[model samples]
Target: MASVAEAYVFLTYLKVLFLTVTTYLTCTAHNSPTRPMFSVFTSYNDSLEKTHGLPTNLSWSQLASTVGEDKTSSSCQPVGIYSIQRHGSRYPEQRIITTYQTFFSRIARSRINEEFAYLKNEPLDRFTVEKAECLTDKGYNELLEISARYPARLFPLFRDPVSIFTQSSFQSTETNRTKESAEAFISGLCKECRFITPKHDEDKLILVMKDGKIYSEIHWLPILHDPLLLPKISSGICKDSIAIEEHSREFYSFKNSPFVEEVLHHVISRLDYTGDFSMTLDELQSLYEICATEMNLFGASNWCKLFSQSDLRAMEYLYDLQEYWYSSYGYRINYLPYCVLLQDIASHLESSVASGSTSTKKIFKFAHSTTIQGLFALLGLYRTSVIPTADNYPLDGNWEYRGGIISPYAANIVFSVFRCAGRSTLPNAIGDVKVLITHNEQPLKIGPCDSYYCDLTTLTSYLRSKVGSCDLDEICGGVVRDLPMKT
Candidate 1:
């Protein structure tokens, strides 16, 4: 046997030789005339700009045409606005990080396409285990920009900054990303505000003070185990097994479909993969996910170069299918879990209208994508006439749901209450208090309403009718644990 140092040197030389040969093969194959003319037709930036997939970055101008110029009726003066926003763009979850490491390792061991040669020694400093699931710098700025836009886009909601600050309440799920997102948003909303961190880690409420006076309060609620946001997990209103079963059936069926398989085959051919490793459908899909998330984090991704517009759309559809089945409009029970939250909002709106004060002027909750999707389902905002399945691709007017537009990072639902000049006998109104709801800064008409603005009492009554009397124990068929009382 050779000496230890000699053996180490010999192994290192072999490794260098292997990498050199691999690089040469990759470059040669890419330049070969036999190689198909397959490259990104639309640039990744343009593709991402047009993408309506779940991972699209949030922008204030995203719906400028669709929303048009500020359409708040001149006769209507804003009183209060209640909003629920998904946390801004965040780093990939731990599982995604782990899978990315594995994928890069596999690529390093293989003779990859020249376009993807960077994967052989891809630096993962941006997506370390320590940063898993935390909001990135880009994510913080997304929320900051969104919060700054409310004054102009939503208009007059923050006209009285002092009153708004004193009365408004901010809440978030018990997650670092959510809390950080809320903080970033508040920074833009209230530039001169001060925060009082809780003395105990167990404390949920944080006091907000301005000029030595208490301005408002921030509440951090439990996540995953929360009663209002994730009742499926908290109260067992929806069975996890059912979702899992449906997801598995669709996941395999769709991935194994002829269309999807053909796309996968094309990708494999372009990759010209030469290694002991065989990529599974799941791993292939993960590549799309990495491309999307990296785009969100850095405004671009090298992995995105591996795909064409069609490929991204196909991959997007897979996730769209997952969101449809798991979160929105897949089953009736999915909506039931959100009743408690809707009912709470109904009470708050009704009370705010009754009080007619800025105390309840702005109520903001920072939550997750699932929370927004489930809430939309509860309100019947986006529904499709045709069911999405592996056999069908509802590409035209048939499909109304697009995950990117509906529940993208920093997705929000806003209910702006306006005091309209009119003559009405409705209780607690000299004329009429109108409620205008918007999804991601664009008008979203509520159920059975022809226009974006609906009567506050009418809207509150409708919400109550849907879920006002929901009994968690009875609805869930089990005793639901309640959130601890705030100290």
Candidate 2:
């Protein structure tokens, strides 16, 4: 019953008051010293549980809370979820293990140098390389935790008990880590369900080459004719000896730099390796790996103390360069493998829409970190324009935004479909289905779709175009013989 003029004035006052309060809260939150920031490594004095990278792998729950989206709106519901995840922490490779043990043995036997005086009486136990290529107990726990938490997050999407189909790409007797990771996740997710054994579907999941013999199975149509697959499309693909040697040279050349030399000297002195000994690039790499592996297994190690924060950051960048050029976004051809995966994702989404309620609710794939990295690059997520170089390593730059974070142990990329109840101008709206892509629990802002939640039809069209451009026969002709294959 109030007058129009009075009501307008009162509403304007309320709006102004609301804006003022919101602005104050936002400013307060931004300026608060207690606010948490993402850190790549914990302080030397901090407990190993606080470490965030390579060694002492981040727990899935901690990662999810730090980077994951907030609770979805009450109205928005998840219809389907597709996820591809990497296995968690594991023992180092045989060569790395040997190098670490040898290095430590030398240190233990070295006449107590002033620099390494602390280790004079410190009982240095020799490390043995056991259970190589197998998941550590911590790795198993990580997947288990993820399975428990992810379901609750997606509960609103499907009120019913959602069906899960798990797949893994580990085929070799030596590489059971992927399969174990998948089993652990399933155990956590469906406690009552039996563990499903993984099938070796090379034609669908992997590209293998042995002794110059290539077994090319074009799983995804988009990569069919892609020329990038021509260069050893198997485990050996990433092991390009020439490329690794070049990278090693670049890394070693930095030793001549005064700053690097000073840091190296300081690190060597602290580790008690001073006195007429110069560290080779190979030695430095081995030392870093030893630090990482020790921390990963035992939660703490003296090796962690040998390097400062700046040194760790530098080493991380070195690793970034290796991973990038070897099998990630930096390599142009790497996208071919993941483009196929994207097509599969598109197909699954299409089926979900076509079948409506009858479609599979969840699709889970377990693979190596390489798979996640390739997909991340193909999707152009967390990519930087400035390519890293040995001399121009951007220490002050956003290194945390690179593959180090994108492909951490147990890293995952998730695509979630939500049936939004709304109207849209696009054709085949089908109740305005939207898809959200998240890497490592954090939602990605896909540039192609230009939104966090992309319209299904638009996303589908883009993915189909990618798939349509492939001609597998042309790309894999040398190895694409008519073998009895299952698609």
Model 2 earns a TM-score of 0.68
Candidate 1 lDDT by residue in tens digits, 1-487: 4699899999999986863443333212322332211111112222234443323232222332334422534466666778898887777678777787787777777887776677666676767779887987867887887787676555555655565574677888888888888878876775556656633246354545645564455577555467776676776444432446654455467778875775576567567756433666766776766777765555466766656554555666767777777777775555667898898788677666663543466789888877888888877777777677777864321344567767777778888777767764356655567777877665667876656677777788778777845776555443322321110
RMSDs, each prediction? 11.9, 16.1
TM-score of each: 0.78, 0.68
- Steric clash count of candidate 1: 1
lDDT comparing candidate 1 with the true structure = 0.64
Best by lDDT: 1
Q: Which ranges of candidate 1 are over 4 A from the true structure? A: 1-72, 153-157, 194-200, 205-216, 237-243, 273-277, 355-359, 394-399, 478-487
TM-score, structure 1 vs. true: 0.78
- Counted clashes in each candidate structure: 1, 7
